[model samples]
Target: MTHRWLHLRLAAPLVAFGDVAIDHVGPTRDFPAASALTGLLANALGLRREETSAHQALQDRLVFGAMVIRPGRLLTDIQNAKLEKKDCGWTTWGQPDVRTGDTYDSPHRRRRDYLADHDCRVVLRLHDLPEGPDLDRLAEVLDRPARPLFIGRKGCLPSAQLFAGWLEGENALEALKAIGLPGRAFWPAEEGGGTVRDISDMRNWRTGLHGGHRRVSEGEIA
Candidate 1:
């Protein structure tokens, strides 16, 4: 059977390929992770977390590849957020006369790192088309996603459309490179610019592969 590929352009003014946040500092990855990308697809298809079958099928069948076209600048932001108190301590909304300050703090300060002015090309090959939206079906869904799609956070909206186009080919990396939209994204000397690196090992976030790590390359696409 001829292989098929799902191509996507994740463009956003302020995108965050979320890195695990610790000690009030949340850093973002240079590129999107397998888990996060899969989750976004799942979200687009309106698949709930309770549906494990669809999620697992997607993870097992898909071979993920990505090119950081325009490597965005990294910026960290510190802000204070007001969180509603879970208990009765924060009854300011319901009971204006009651005192809630003693119970819970209103705002918490945290630092978040983000990738600004970024555009990336993500391609996926479906080795196995499961019961539901395999890959093509998923792509169709992306064209008119059931829910609004965001980069990492809900607020970080995509500047460009996610569904760029599709391709039919056996080579995942070559197809990605051919379709890759190159730009002047930032890349240090250590990290090769315009080289497509395999990020399968670092796919799942719950399985402890968060901190923007890509391991075991199948060689660079160059």
Candidate 2:
């Protein structure tokens, strides 16, 4: 049987600018209800901010739900229910019946193939920016030359560095950051190591995987 999971939804799109956007769909904590999984997935795929073609297939799901796919698999022809507040049930990209998998490896290849066909890539600009329990704490932790950036929902796009900027009134760095890290996953560490691993081996020196690194800055923080 196919394993299933649900995530919660939080926050909404606040702004959109040029190519990048911002959204407040992060979870309140680590609850298990619904999540911004689809949003992240759609965003990652570099789907044009105005594209709604795939929204119906994965809306109102949790960020965690998007990670349910096995590594190196594609998820295509996947369809969703026509209603909200539901599981957003899914099917294969091309086939009718649920694309069944035999072993865990089966699902991985399937998902990888589906994503390849649809050209999926997650966007994570806001997540790349700094975020902590509080802005103050976040500010302290994010005082590096590397400007703060994150993934945005819809309306929340970075323009003048007004809200999600290092300085309150700067745009140069904002624009530069936008070009550098257009996607969002750059912010949150993958579950295990790459993208969907359950637990990352902090001591995986061999793989060069460990604790997170601060986005370095050009000059000293002013």
Candidate 3:
């Protein structure tokens, strides 16, 4: 079956593909996570953080594959900040995230990893559902999102447009190769053909937690 796919170019000065984080150390994967891609699409559709059900539904419907057009260098950022109980920080939802604890004499610190000068291409299609947003809707919303769209993180903004047109293929892997942009690629295992690896990238938005592992094929798609 020939499936229609939406093409997205994720070229950014700094791109952070989320990984399983422990404590104050936040790591990034080489390619985008399924959860992160879902969040990006939800944001483009103007879904709020509080809209857990909507986010969950959208995530469940997403099907995609990604290719690293440029293997950018990994950049690590060490951050430290001291804050008072009354201090508040801005959020993407247009609300202030206030610090609830007492004033801290010491600085709160964390390490974050980002991909610097990276370029990636994604081919996405939605599962056949009775109702919900489709590929055309996603492309439209991404072009003129209700809110500003960011790649992975808010500070890691895209250097180019997210929508790169469309492609048709038998599966996500086939669609990716049709682009003719060679690099390491990752796709759902069921799509067939690659080194199978178990990855925990899905998220339970309702509980705000990382969920079970899913199999993916990782290999070069030249």
Best by TM-score: 3
lDDT of 3 by residue, 1-222 (tens): 999999999989999998999999999988888899989999999998999998888889988999999988999999999888898988777899987789988999999999999999999999989777988999999999988888888899899999999999999999999999789999999978899999998999999998678999999976
Off by over 4 Å in 1: 84-103, 180-222
CA displacement after TM-score superposition, residue 25 of candidate 1 (Å)? 1.9
For candidate 2, the clash count comes to 63
**Model 1 agreement with the true structure over 1-116: per-residue lDDT tens digits:** 44567888898989888765578887888767666777788889998876766666676565766668777999888899664544334333576444355433567888888888
Q: Quick one: ranking by lDDT, best first? A: 3, 1, 2
Candidates 1 and 2, the one with greater TM-score = 1
- Which model, 2 or 3, shows the larger lDDT? 3
| Deviation in Å, model 2, residue 100 alpha carbon | 52
lDDT of 2 at 77: 30
Tens digits of per-residue lDDT for model 2, 1-222:
211111111222222111111241221211111123333344434445445433333332212211111122222232222332322334446644533433232222111011111111221122122321223332333333132332232322323222233222122223223333232222223222233223221122223223222221121111
lDDT for residue 43 in candidate 3, whole number 0-100 = 91
The order by descending TM-score is 3, 1, 2
Off by over 4 Å in 2: 2-27, 31-35, 60-222
After TM-score superposition, the amount by which residue 3's alpha carbon in candidate 1 deviates from its true location, in angstroms, is 2.5
